[model samples]
Target: MNTESPVSRRAALCGIVVALAVPSGLVTACGSPAPSGTGSGSTPKQNGSTPTSASSGGALVALADVPEGGGAVVDGPGGKKIVVARISATEVKAYDATCTHQGSTVAEPSGGTITCQSHGSQFSPADGSVKKGPATTGLRAVAVRVQGDQVVLA
Candidate 1:
């Protein structure tokens, strides 16, 4: 008779993996991933340009793309969508394109209002405030500024 019981192959491999992977911080599947591209693949190139960080003021879109009294939906940081509205010639405001009511994406600001086609939610372009029904809350504000002729994340 064998003096000691044999351990299964799966058990041995699990032990080896935990010993090696845990110590090196390679085991990350235990919890859910992060939001806002906070996970492993956050740094991505946009518009075929070099990767830029918010601390360094990343360019989002050209100023000409956004009309004087209207706004334009553009790709924001972490692959998120945002509405960049031109408040005036030298001022711009931005907000999350995701609608607060039902997680729908809001459209560009037209006639001085950003409209969500999903539920007819209208928001103010200057301050991201709710202006119509179906949406009780306004779109979330995104930190951004106009840098030269480019709209950049601030």
Candidate 2:
């Protein structure tokens, strides 16, 4: 005899749809607007080739933009979103803004942690490591270096 309740069956179907839609790129959660050439279906542009708001003539952002022990979300190489954090006065780190769990753009780092609003995933700005659930994988690291007064892709 079928013992599955109607509510349970509906919930299961909804779960299936979300599972399929997320991986298939049919759904995108909370995040900043992705650049024109960068999306799940589109091929990401090569580094140093795509122009972004954060980068100008090879500079990703001004060092002043990132506060000490905090971070900012900037348009990154390949037209992708990147989170740049200032660990110390002379130290900085960068990571792909897309959350590993669901592709939602991570929020700016506060208290040395990056948070994903979509699913509440937390990541450490120090090494892009996941510190919360729903995201088992860490954020992708992006090479970054400080040049004079600006942050540039390394």
Model 2 stretches astray by more than 4 angstroms: 1-57
Give the Å error, residue 56, model 1: 5.1
lDDT of 2 by residue, 1-154 (tens): 9896566775666566667764434333323233465544433333322212334347778999999999899987677888899999988888889898989999999976899999999998888888897998888777688889988887
lDDT of 1 by residue, 1-154 (tens): 8899899886677666666773333334323233445444544433222233444488888999989999899988778888889999989888878888999899998998999999898988878888897888767666678888999888
Model 1 clashing residue pairs (backbone)? none
Residue 108, model 2: Cα distance from true site in angstroms? 0.6
